[model samples]
Target: MRYFEFILILEIGILLLLSLFGKKLLNRRIVSAFVLVTLVAHYFLEGIRWQMYPTYLMAFFILLFYNHDFLRKRKWYIKTILIFCLLLLAVSGAVAKLVPVFDLPDTTSRYAVGTSNFTLEDSKRSNRKLNMKFWFPTSKIGSPDGVYSENPVQTLDGLFDMPGFVFGHLNRVETETYNNAEILNDSIKFPLVVYSHGAASSHLDNTGLLREIAGEGYVVLALDHDFSFSDYNLKKSDAMTLEYVAQKAFITDLIDKVVPNQVQDIEFILGNLPNSNYNLVDHINFEKIALMGHSLGGTTATDASFNVQGIQAIVNMDGPLNTASIEQLELPFLYMSSFSPDISDKSLEEKGLPDAMLYRRVKQWELENVYRLHDRNTIGFHWVRFRNAGHMDFTDVPFMLPIMKTDSYDEHKGHLLKSSVILDFIDIHLKNGKNYQKVKDQSLEWIK
Candidate 1:
């Protein structure tokens, strides 16, 4: 919770307790003035969120009921009001805790991050429109006042499967990237990292991570694939639930086409980068390009690495290699999977069960990549798992919608591990950068 928000809520709770147990000690005029002051401070300082509306209403209720001698003297009326206030407080607190303001960790690099969006039309594929954002190293000094996402309404609806109005306050969330800031123009050419979001996700899903990478002297090109922005409503449902089954067949059919289309999108963007007018492209080191993505996007990166030439490295964050022929991938590859020992057949033995079937395939696909990495010829390959982490833990979805959380690992800590590990991997492979013996994390277990 934010500073003034916590203070306001706590003060109200104290007032409620005093009304019940110590009404003689309660100062009605002083309490009313303090509540009004706190409410103003919370509104101006922390910002008002819909989740706290009930609590805000409760403050007004206290002003109406507590200040009135007739209502206060009637014990039954007071008890009824207290019960209603308790319900309101519970609802408000729960919602507030569930969807708290998601402030991303600060960028830890010397360079300030700069981001800009571009629309690319693919001539070969029916003039398919693709949106991409460039997060690049910037020489600009001031902190960014820009909002984190461009399409918060779409993000809330598509990513979290929630009504846009519930989290409309997210539109006010600030980020660390300056919009269209001047690209760092030092003589050194920056390594390019093309990032792809998970299926049914936005390029801005991992905005925090992309900014962190850009701050570390890399040009991070985040792609908004044609399928992710399509009319498909991909609910964030658990694999074990009936909701997933209802959507499974449709998702399967669409995803088969989605992966190939995304690979084409990546290829098109990479092929056209040099010819493009974006200034950030001029600083890109074409020779040192890396493909990185989450979920199905990670699959696309691996697939693209095989089909497209000049990709120096690949990073797949907890994405299954379902569509990718990983055996053909020859570049430096990093596969990061969430810790899921229960994915094994022994642990989840219901082989024919619909939920288990999907789980099995995902686990099998991840295992295939892990097995390939263990091969003697597969050099520059790393497989690591975040302990007690879930699939969406790699993305920003969990921060905004905690209901999506499936594991106990801290999301903030997981991000730090991801940023540092990816930075070290790309540095070593793309920039011939530092060599870490192992990325030191208690939860991040290195498996070969």
Candidate 2:
């Protein structure tokens, strides 16, 4: 159940209340106006289009019934309004039932060294912390199907003006199915890749991408940036209020701080993993470590490579470069952007941050081995524009939202294209041999 569904139930309750207390509030135009306003607000705010017509009919019933005392005298108008409202309600109910509400193909895989609560001391601050979950390939383990966080429902509830029933039902619901890791013959140490999610996003937000990368014989370590994007309980606010604040800050200063902090977190994880009780060290080919992130996380990947030693390559998935940070980075880097110069001017301004500033900054950091891709560039970049892609498309939420008939991605095709491009870029840069001719052979469309 979502907040919108709760609104529907609330509306039903209101209708019942109106029936019981009609005579008491019959003369109160303010009450009627308040109901009407709430209906309109629900329609626009929750995308509950079907509810509008029925609500209008309900309003008509209240207006007509309140004026006439005898059913015999107002039989025609009363009956007509009742019939219309019932019909509209029935149709709306049918439409809601038939339409898909959410759609993310759930998947999971088992690992022996799937440790949690691996804490690291923050280098920059006192009494600070970082936590990570390492899912390394394992053998002979009785791992059940995995489950995703209940945060999404809580998040939707907080963001939308929906009811508690919808969100409360989803709180901490496990929603993923895991399978045994795919076996490989003559298994050797796998490549290591550190994953960073966008601001206000949880590590589980990109499970679809993480599982895919892990399935490809790479150890994908996702870092949870404290106070950055993961769930935070504000000392003064309630749970709902805190969630709202966290979601809003996800794209703002919260992300900016998370990006740099993620670098430190990754370095800590890597240094400690080799010596921890968990056998992650034996599974990873540390020499081939790569860093990747979506949006702000992508920027962090770029910056981390400079700060963290032994990071061979970095991939930025639709993430803009910080001009100051880019200058310091010297490793092989790949910039995968959805924007193109031909698309709407709204692209650069709306996507994440200012494009002109990012463009000028990235240009200064462009090295001979650096590869760049943008719209319609088949050889190097994915064939899509930033205008069509939402910042959320690169994650697994889009797929799930589509199935549940929730508002996730603007377009399914664009989301698929974005994910595919990101997977391919990772494959090329992380899995494939470094100094591969493909990077140099690619053409560059230098946008001024």
Candidate 3:
């Protein structure tokens, strides 16, 4: 249990004991003051969460009743109310929040990180307003808000049509990235890595990798295409056509609409960064920009790589590109995948542990996408499929909840291993020229 939770449990115990004997201690100012002080301290310290209001009311009411001789009932009903309040107060703190802390990785360089958000118009898609998030290297580390998102459970609950508690403590996850840290002053230009999230996900979906990479002295920007609570349009899920699901009309709509919409979002970020008023723009080496994302966002990254002039590479995490126009693609690429389609079910029940339906979909998706990757005759692409990682393992969701993690490999180690591989690939293509064949041979299964 967390410090706050323990404190809450103790406070509830004291409150129950006090109400029964509060009348005896009423005239004693110090004891009365102590109880009242603890009550206010509890709420004020956490900054007055709305969830604590009921407990606050009950505690204060108990105090008022005990102090007033007329209202102080030595009756069964009074005891019942006190007992009820005590239980409610204790339970509130337990199920209230997780207050997650980021397990920040040690950096190779002395690093500083900063973030900035931009809202712009999506001209192609009815000029809808869009939001962008950025994480960049700074000269001196700055103080961060620590929170990555406000209420993730509610946002995803509505989208996935699942219970909110599936991701309980989702809102409590704190980010280690500093809020608008001072931009690095060095003259050497830094490579820019633009991040896109999976469909029905926000810019924060891959925050763990983004922060880790930013610590390695790269400028990372995670754009939020749909960062609102008002009925998220999950149309992007249809953006890529799986061989089994490609015949549906919605798949066509996905190709024509959602794919372009995401590609445009990446382009918009690239276009806006050159003249961006943010101090870090001076450090961005526009000629060495790259795009990466999970799932649908990966597809977007691949699409962006096609037209974007200065892009040095594209990193797609378990997401297949929707376009059949991969023949002419010249950009260097990094493709990471979960278990392939051919893996057996017995192996899956022990390793992946996803629901039966999800496992089926993943296998089929893998079959089609793997075929696509094979058909593309590109010297620049390096595809890696982890031995036993679940589909969510490529992203941060599994790491967020240890219980939910069913991947055969440990989530953190797997992610760290992947991040190291990614940094090496970027080092070779974007910054310094390095041989990746050795590292690739040992750590990854070379696909095609």
Q: Compare the candidates by TM-score and give the number of the best one.
A: 1
The superposed Cα distance between candidate 2 and the true structure at residue 297, in angstroms, equals 1.3
Predicted candidate 1, C-alpha RMSD: 4.2
Quality of model 3 by C-alpha lDDT: 0.65
Instruction: List model 1 lDDT by residue over 1-448, tens digit each.
Output: 7777777788788777666653664677898888889899988877788879988988887777777665445477776777678777878888888888778876687788888888789888889888888888887887686677656666545553446676666766778778878888889899899999887667888988888888888988998884543344443443224543444554454456577778888888888878888767778888888999998888788788876667899999976665347557667888888765455655443222345555655555456646765664577888888766777888887777777765455777777888888888888888776664678867878886
Give RMSD to native, each candidate: 4.2, 11.3, 5.4
What tens-digit string does per-residue lDDT give for candidate 2 at 99-122? Answer: 323344433333332323355665
Give one digit per residue, the lDDT tens place, for model 3 in 267-303.
7767876886766677888999888888768877888
On the 0 to 100 scale, the lDDT of residue 69 in model 1 is 62
Reference-based TM-score of each model: 0.84, 0.55, 0.76
| Sliding window of 10 residues with minimal summed lDDT for model 1 | 345-354
Q: TM-score winner between 1 and 2, please give it.
A: 1
Ranking of all candidate structures by their lDDT, best first: 1, 3, 2
Please list the residue runs of candidate 1 whose C-alpha ends up more than 4 Å from where it truly belongs after superposition.
Answer: 17-22, 63-66, 73-78, 123-127, 154-156, 226-255, 340-362, 403-408, 434-436
TM-score of 2: 0.55
lDDT of each model, Cα atoms only? 0.75, 0.51, 0.65
